[model samples]
Target: MATVRVQQADFDIGAEVAAVTAGRTDIGGTGCFIGTVRETADGRPITAMTLEHYPGMTERAMAAIAEQAEARWSLLGCTLIHRVGRLTPGANIVLVLAAAPHRQAALEATAFLIDWLKTRAPFWKKEHFADGAEAWVAARVEDDAAAARWGGGTAGRDRRTMAPGGSG
Candidate 1:
């Protein structure tokens, strides 16, 4: 079983990793990734970014991502915590930790979880510039490509996936 959390409160990286690996004697390796608000992008400083998410769908989507990771790898344990609402620069935004007997599975599972979350989760981001301007973050084609890797191309496409010419 895996744990998934979507909330306004931020998560503690050490605590989450501890909880994920607790009582797991079989786990020989753990891979952890924490995504935080960055001060700059490319090279320019980012003033702020507001993150929004659908209530029910956000949790469900994250759970499904975790489930897929477990199914695709020999995972002993995993934890995903995502923060919502207003957040400041340098704050923790999300955490993903995967525990397994080997490093490969742990690493791959972590990537799969974040990639799927970025593409499929209902979260939206709005970047606010230093001059007091805001814009809704658009879903990048690169993110979709990342998710497709774990999705195994068209064979594993879901309802969220609609062909370019198909009505969405």
Candidate 2:
């Protein structure tokens, strides 16, 4: 099973990783990704960012994403934590961890999870600039392209199943 959480509080990466790997001797590799608030967006200086999402809906969407990752890869465990509400520059925004029997599955699953989250998750973000202006962040074409690379699209589309070895 996968653990998913959407909270306002920041998460400890080390603790989360340990929680996923604990009592798991079969996991030979673990892939992790941590997203943080940057000091700048585009060329503008960003002071802070506020993230918002529909509570129940957001959790359900994230859980589905995790499930998809586990189905597509040989994953033993997964954890996804996304922080909501206002966040300052350098603050942690999201964390994703994928554990599998081999490095390829672990790494690819992690990438797929994050990419899907960026494009499919229902989180909304508003950026506060240094000039005392605020604007809602728009969807990026790059994120959609990243997700598409993993054969991501409409529901019910068949995705290639990957195992420990090179064969899929």
Please tell me which predicted candidate would have the highest TM-score against the true structure.
2
- Superpose all Cα atoms of candidate 1 onto the true structure and report the RMSD in Å to 1 decimal: 2.8
Q: Scored by CA lDDT, what does every candidate get?
A: 0.80, 0.90
Question: Which ten-residue region of model 2 has the weakest summed lDDT?
Answer: 152-161
* All candidates: TM-score: 0.87, 0.91
- Would you list the clashing residue pairs of candidate 2? none
After superposition on all C-alphas, the RMSD of every candidate to the true structure, in Å, is 2.8, 8.6
Tens digit of per-residue lDDT, candidate 2, span 27-146: 999999999999999989999999999889888889999999999996899999999999999999999999999999999999999999987778999999999999999777687678
Q: Give lDDT tens digits, candidate 1, residues 1-168.
A: 888998888787878888988776899888888989887654556688788888998888788778888888978898988888877789889999889999999999989888887877788887776667667776777877887777565433343536777643
TM-score of 1: 0.87
- The local distance difference test score of model 1 is 0.80
